[model samples]
Target chain A: MAEQDLTSSSILIAQAQTDTGNSEAQQPGNAAGTNDAVEEQVVQEANDAAQGITVVVEGSEVVAADPAVELHAETQGAYTEQEKSVFPPFDSSTFGPQLFWLALTFGVLYLLMSKIALPRIGEILEVRRDRIEGDLAEAERLRQKTDQAIEAFEAELAEARAKSHGIADETRAKIKSEMDAKRRDVEADLAKQVATAEARILKTKTDALANVDQIAAETAVAVVGKLAGKVSIKDARVAVSDVVKG
Target chain B: MAGTDPISQFKVKTLFSFGTIGADENGANGVDLVFTNSALFMVLTVGLIATYLILSTRGRGLVPSRLQLVSEMSYEFIANMVRSSAGTEGMKFFPLVFSLFSFILIANMWGMFPYFFAVTSQIIITAALALLVMAVVIIYGVWKNGFGFLKLFVPSGIPLPILFIVVPIEVLSFLSRPLSLSLRLFGNILAGHIVLKVFAGFIVSLSALGALGMFGSILPFVMAVALTGLEFLVSALQAFVFAILTCIYLNDAIHPGH
Candidate 1:
């Protein structure tokens, strides 16, 4: 209301200024129509500026012709009593509606979230989780299979190593037994040859002894004629026998 | 002229009357339930949340899209908070906590837009929300723990002498939950926005001054820009704080012990 009054007052001032200018133009010695037109133009500009202020700011009013200082003062005073009551947030008049709408909207949000929105999101998450878990389980199974295959390969390797060691041992034993049998047969042949030579030497010694006794007997008969040679041969044989027995 | 007055931004103008209940000497001053910009934004907030949550997961891919991933992360973030603070049994309140979290976070984000109404900025609105949370805590606390809920005030392992001092403080803090919860959000938003408007208004006023003033306006212009970024952070942070605080209070209701 104050702003409208101020705007109307400014329009009145503009009209009064135009009227004075028009009356002055009509007086003698005053500039004619041109002067009135210039005055009207200035007044029109002022009217426009004031109307502009009214349009820009509603409650706080100042005369359009006021200097910057007064304009600042008016601007400072803009927070009037009406502004206090009309402050949107604290305005008690809006509370009922704000509350009503808050409840209605928030309630709708809750119902939508709880019933539809969130569950759907959760189901998506659950599906993703299940997928990841399944993939992990499959991976674990493959790793286990790989481990078992590796274990079997190692077992085979160990068995082959043990079999090769057994074969080497058997070959070594067979070679050693064959060499031992060949050495035993050669030793037995040498022993038999030596015994036979010894038996022949003993037989030759006995025959030589018998021949000495007969030669001694024949020599004694011849020696009886040739002196004591025969008697000496028989005596020599007996002496030899007695000496051998002794 | 009141554009410089930051408080003007928060003023609730009635777009239309829903219905009037207590019609009095002032024909409209009755329980004139009007849908307002605030109300519209509230609906928008709810609508945005619902649409995103519902539509993003429509694909239900084993590998989620970016939108679906964000929704899942938000869900898990709130879910973890509730679970960690209140434990597994408190998962019972998941929907409620989820709803509150989404409502606050989305509403705060909407407020970040220039010329958009911040639902969280309203004292009545924040107060009502705080009261609602407290109501849940108190009612659920009492119902779940019976008289044992009072044990939340009397922490265990305190000496008898100290409890005399401590118990009352606990109860006082408990009683002030709604006040603190509501004011924390309201004050932060109100102050942040007011500061932003003030600085923004400064740029306009200063630029009106000649060339040198234009250079001077640069400072406020930068300040306003920086403040906008901070406001975005604050919007998200306030929502996070509100959610975590709700979980903590729910925990008190769940266990009702120190």
Candidate 2:
């Protein structure tokens, strides 16, 4: 659609050029022939009508600028008389300067590109490439270092776990041995107390038995002496012996 | 005080006249060396290109600034175009392609400004540049491939009887390359500018009628505005087309078979 628009517009321009060319060729003949007389007559009539209007306005106390009107008309006339060629670029007179300048400017630009701008840009691109490569190499080295550090950390963690297990085992054995020694001492003290308690009981019983025998012997002798003075110690002693044997 | 004629805008007026120089009796100063408006714009184009490419990269930072990025992008754009069209061996002609691209691109852009003359609109200038490209192609093709370059005018796989008719047609088409290349750029620019001027003329002429005419002038004014925008695109597109064509032609130089 856009391309069609361009082609149609270009066709319009070509038509306009041809029209201008024909008009230019006819311009001299029109001026020299009767057409100029008709144009002058029309201009005269228009001038008269403008003047009549101005005079009427002046009678109403309004002033018109006559000089400005004349100037405008003169300029319009000059514009109409200007060259009618549509394509100025085809003029041969201007070609030399246009070509000369084109060559000069284009040559200078070519030199600037090949000599300076392009090479400088190439250098910058090269520097960027090298910088990026260096950064990548450094990153790889740091990554390797990180990997080694992680491996070492893991190894130390494993050793620490083994040492903790050994320490715990040692602590449990020491606690058990100390508790066994305390128990043995307590048992020995208890056994000694029990032996002393038995010895006290045996002593008390022996004392009481000896007291009973003496009392009994004394009572028997007193009774025999009081009742039958003449009854002998032999009889009392035999009585006491028989009672003890029973 | 003549009224402005839009067509006069394209005229190349003499800025300084050196009044000819050399051995011709009819020549005023013997040479027709006159600095012109076209010359001024051409210089301006070159200056702008230099500023964009050279000064922009003066810092050459690892992280590019906007200007530097633009310069680099332009460089790579042309470089890659050449590489793709002409192959890696075409890189040797990188400077030529680069120069042509930047010059035309800047010239086209600078012409977009109001009251500025568009150099590429001239058939003479574009024709000269196109002829230069053709010259390079012929010289390089003959030098590198010798008589083998003539094979470009003779297609392969054609029967012997048909070769006679096909060969002349091929040569004629080959010779028309520069003409087409130059005319395409020139016509696009010339027609666009002319359309813009006509629309602008409508606005001026319409607005002179009265209050109603002033209001009616808005239509042409809008059209002129729209055309200005379109011209901007046309300028850039034409420059790109011209550059790519140059690369394709140069490719024929480097490898001249079908």
**Which lDDT tens digits does candidate 2 get at residues A67-91?**
3332322222111222334346876
Prediction RMSDs, each to the true structure: 12.3, 17.0
TM-score of every model versus the real structure: 0.72, 0.64
Who wins the DockQ comparison?
1
Per-residue CA lDDT of candidate 1, range A8-48, in tens? Answer: 76776777686766667666476658666767776786677
TM-score of 2: 0.64
Return the clash pairs for model 2, or none: B19-B29, B20-B29, B20-B30, B20-B31, B21-B29, B21-B30, B21-B31
Query: Compared with the true structure, what per-residue lDDT tens digits does model 2 show for residues B1-258?
Result: 124466776776667765455634533223466778899999999999987789999999999999998988888898899999999999989999888888888888888887888998889999999999999999999999999999888888999889999999999988999999999999998888878888888888888898998999999999999999999899988889988999999898898888
Provide the clash count, candidate 1: 3
The TM-score measured for candidate 1 stands at 0.72
Q: Estimate every model's Cα lDDT from 0 to 1.
A: 0.80, 0.79
Model 2 stretches with alpha carbons more than 4 Å out: A1-86, A148-246, B1-4, B23-29, B157-165
Give the Å error, residue B68, model 1: 2.4
Alpha-carbon DockQ of candidate 1: 0.30
What are the DockQ scores of the candidates, in order? 0.30, 0.26
